[model samples]
Target: MGARCSKFSLCWWPSHIRSNRHDSSDVDEKDSLPGFIEYSLDQLRAATSGFSPDSIVSEHGEKAPNVVYRGKLEDDRWVAVKRFNKLAWPDSRQFLEEAQAVGQLRHMRLANLIGCCCQGEERLLVAEFMPNETLSKHLFHWENQPMKWAMRLRVALYLAQALEYCSSKGRVLYHDLNAYRILFDQDANPRLSCFGLMKNSRDGKSYSTNLAFTPPEYLRTGRVTAESVVYSFGTLLLDLLSGKHIPPSHALDLIKSKNFLMLMDSCLEGHFSNDDGTDLVRLASRCLQYEPRERPNAKSLVTALAPLQKETGAPSYVLMSIPQVSSSSKQTVPLTPLGEASYRRDLTAIHEILEKVGYKDDEGVANELSFQMWTNQLQETLNSKKQGDAAFRAKDLSTAIDCYTQFIDGGTMISPTVYARRCLCYLMNEMPQEALGDAMQAQSVSPDWPTAFYLQAAALFSLGMDDDARESLTDGASMEAKKHRN
Candidate 1:
């Protein structure tokens, strides 16, 4: 269970544009919040391919209490879906109310809440998807070079602006604020996740990280104040400076000892001036003060960091080396017949091809059992295959998957075709991750099989890994050409 915020006043627009008088231009109450949508469960399911495991983008994966999934809308707009656990927000009405409050907020510095769903016992929130991933991934466990000093400073400033905006909108508290809560948009600019603006549960447990990272006041009061958010922001500042999670106390000690240079990330060397480094360190120390009242507000934070910002003219994507693309842009790639079918997810075409191929390539792969006592086991395994094939032909995908599972578990036969068929079944059922596993299994059973690669491309396409899908499609075409020449 997590924390829940108190109900607050709602205004659709910023304070500057807010109007107290009703106008004829307001066509509908729902339309008042321009981009906010109340999505149906079925719509979300289709978007994320029935919430496939491969769609999960949260830091903790499926194991997280509330899982975040990357999904594309019917309009092809990418989104992040946060599915809260059953215990979170037991009262559906309260969940909707909170979602509405957060949904009204739209800020470039924030990963704005796009919509929410409250069907039955399920509680979910949807927001604009940030494709570049989270600060935790880039700062703490980056695969490429560590985040640049310019980008780091930009992230801090953007986050502060997000907080200030939320505060102005009367949504002040942010639960479990951490590196994971800061996401990089498609343009590589950092935006604070709106998910943190909503509470995880009603249990008064505001923080979810290690106790060391939790604000000391929260440890004692079991609550989070607006000031508590500033403390977490301090921790984030420390993360940017050190590229590590240094406990607040440890960070403050180093700051007090005049060990500011030691507190900075070694990777940041030659990238920032000593003065800039000292300024950020000093700001972090002020935010980490023992007295909550002494901490700076979000506005002050923005003011302090504004002058320290570097590379003011450069776009974030350039600094991060993330490819920039227009929203309407599409990748152009030549595809083979099967590859084209996969790209379009044309199940009818895919089915016809699989039916034509049948199990010709899998013949004689099964080992014959020498013992007569195991004869019944072999018969059962063969029976499962027959049932699976029959179900697959009839397009009873669930039944086909069950029968295929039984055959795979039997271990008496090795049929690449069975894996390929099951892979198609999983795809038709909108379970791309499972389909991917089956496709990989098919490849291991018969490495040169073009069908396996084609199936892989289909699953990858469904999961929105377009670049990988293109490569797989090319491989499948190459293998098909080699087979034709043979």
Candidate 2:
């Protein structure tokens, strides 16, 4: 969660607004938040042509997708579709969870939540669709370029105002305020969306919840404080100002450079206003302070950007440098106590989550079983790479074999999980042939792992291929030695 502040008290948000004419049931009791519309699952399915893959609007690829379905309401108004991945999906309980937590805002800078659908096993949410996608798509790319200086502030002000409104009027925290989530309407107004990552202090834990947007204190303590949000907002401001992803891991090193120009989106083509951008740079720097106390509150952040709102016009986004992630650099955190799942870089864990959701509507029983098995295989692949002691690591091989056999039955698209664990388990069982076969498979999946090499060597040794075993053993030993050094 981006929001985390227990010491700083947030004031009434809608500091500059009037109430919506929509129904009151949707508003928060404390602040009378904005109203929302609702839609049924049947209506959404029809609009999306039965929720086909072609209807997908924005995808984070393979995993978290923002599938868009074009549908008309009973009254004939067109609505945009949002088919969320299962983790971010709202069941009946989560529907109100988001609305109550952060969906009550009525601002030009924020998107309106229309309604949602939660059929027996399917889940989807709906919001007023902004024709233009996220500012991120343009601002963070090189070939696409950056927005004009004046335009950057315009977007920044609108977002600051929205953030201010959330803090003051709604009394909620938008724990995830990344550049990728803000949407631009037809008229170029930024409508904030996706409160699926929000947390409510009124719920009483007093700590923020979203991790990518949170600081260490919030992570160390299970408190959802308002200050945490201030920190997150600061990070957002920094991203808007600098035009780069402020990874908490590299935040310190980047800050040490004090190179605001390096941080600013280079795509702006040198169009930013001199004084205004400087001020924004300073404010953004303050918001991302390592010390929570050093960060400004929501009111201060809004006040800092107030002057820049005066120099606005057609919207343009800043072009910041995009961070490059190695193909295999993705992390794998255990989704939950076997109840939930999240995205991973490799093909692993994709099926476990599908099984958890368990589609029952139209698919055949055998297909369902095969799907479940494939998902199980993905989970096994994930578990194989997790951090554990050598003793505990031994069990991962056997577990992976079970998972691989299930998917290798030729019922799924994902690759088999058999090869990676073959050597380890074969070594355990003294079966060189099975070990060699699996070692080859493991190399095909991820050649970066030294385990596959070591296992192949061990298999060769058992097969009496002394020269091959010696060379492989040396390579494997070197890799293991490097691993130990790290």
Which is the leading candidate under lDDT? 1
Tens digits of per-residue lDDT for model 2, 211-293: 55576567777555566766766666666766776664455455567655656666664576666666776776677676778
Off by over 4 Å in 1: 1-34, 59-64, 200-204, 325-486
Deviation of model 1 at 11, angstroms: 40
Give candidate 2's error at residue 240 in angstroms.
2.6
| lDDT (CA) per prediction | 0.78, 0.50
Stretches > 4 Å off in candidate 2: 1-35, 60-70, 74-76, 84-91, 100-103, 142-144, 197-214, 222-224, 248-258, 313-486
Compared with the true structure, the alpha-carbon lDDT of candidate 1 equals: 0.78
Tens-digit lDDT track of model 1 for 1-486: 011211112211122322211111112233322477889999888877799886787634233567788777766566789887777788888888889888888777778888999998788889888766689988998754889998899888888888887887787899989998998875678888988888645533568747988888998898888999999999999999999999999989888999998899998889899999999999999999999999999888888988887887777866885533221222112234566577567777899889887889786575666576266687898889999999999999999999989988887777889989999999999999888888888877777777887888789889988666656765665566445335
